[model samples]
Target: MITGELKNKIDALWDMFAAGGLVNPLEVIEQITYLMFIRDLDDTDNVRAKESVMLGIPYQSIGDYKERPNMIGMYKTALPKDVAEKMRELLQWYSKQEKNLTTLAEFHVRYEIIHPFQDGNGRTGRMILFREALKSADVDPFIIQDDNRSSYIEGLKEYREEQKTDKLVSLMQQETVDYYQQCSYFME
Candidate 1:
């Protein structure tokens, strides 16, 4: 039941996955489930909220010299020994910042850079995003699409290298609105 450009794109996707040793197609589905991250915002201290994202994970550090990769392997992560301090710094920074989209954007980028959790960094980081969205309006996850995928990465990189979060905040705000508009009708 598939053909044309869409099929081509799917084929390319399969090729990419195949190159990465992902033979089981179900793995793609599982990864997609992982992408369904983030949650609603609350007034409580979100520090623990983000920390609790990775249950049974360390608060201090993980290994003798652990360093995790970004989804795209953009740059190195915080040194293993520095994970605790870096996380503390990120939390302190988060506490002082406003509980809004901009702060959420920067906090997420910083959290990803820290790579606090041993294996669930993205899952945990994604949680912080939805919590903020939940605070103001309905939960609106970034709609999974080809464009959003690339834009999301660009937003992260912009934050990391240039220390600019405007692009990311804008993207999230728009994604919030788009997600609501596209999906809210089904709820009604």
Candidate 2:
């Protein structure tokens, strides 16, 4: 259950995104994605730290500036030993980093393949990708609006599991570029 203060933070984040001139749904969703990941990791890290102290277990915060491998090791341990903590850490990192469109698309593909969260990962990943796209290029968010569920799932699966993000990245890049072109012409 989100406390009132946390809810207010989420609302404030949404408001900040809106005020940033992100008029497209994709932009809004993407911003939410980045913010959500940050919030999740920050909150989880704090909770886990408290648990560690209470249980007398050793725990390192992911944000600590240890070597990459050590940080990753700590991240892997972040998820409950009985749960999928590594995946959560991976997706959380993906949201915070600013990658190129190709990389961003590939990261999303890989992330979805892992399916870190128990739920809402696909939609959330897409939202994060769209939000980064908004920052990377001036365009509205694109939706997978077709009724063909197989195609959509397959598209993400190809990238996440099969290492086939080239096509997905290409597709998203083209769409963003096209949208920007349209916007530019309209403004002119």
Which candidate number maximizes lDDT? 1
In candidate 1, the residue pairs with backbone N, CA or C atoms under 3 Å apart (3 or more residues apart, or in different chains) clash, namely 39-130, 39-131, 40-131, 41-131
lDDT of 1 by residue, 1-188 (tens): 67899989978877887898876644543344445442211222255446766686544332222454334375777766788898889889888876777778888889888786555565556655765555444434543344686777788889888999988777887886776676554244
Which 10-residue span in candidate 2 carries the lowest summed lDDT? 66-75
Report lDDT (Cα) of residue 61, candidate 2.
Answer: 72
- The global C-alpha lDDT for each of the candidates, from Candidate 1 onward, is 0.65, 0.58
Off by over 4 Å in 2: 1-84, 88-98, 137-143, 147-151, 177-188
Total backbone clashes of candidate 2, pairs 3 or more residues apart or in separate chains: 3
Q: Could you tell me the lDDT of residue 88 within candidate 1?
A: 88
TM-score of each model, paired residue for residue: 0.56, 0.43
lDDT of 2 by residue, 1-188 (tens): 56699889966866776798876655565555567767887787788889989999777675432222211211231233423555666668776865676667667766654444533455566766666555665434544333544555666656545667666755675565655664453243
User: What are the RMSDs of all candidates, in order?
Assistant: 13.9, 11.0
Question: Deviation in angstroms for 54 in model 2?
Answer: 36
Which stretch of 10 consecutive residues in model 1 shows the poorest summed lDDT?
36-45
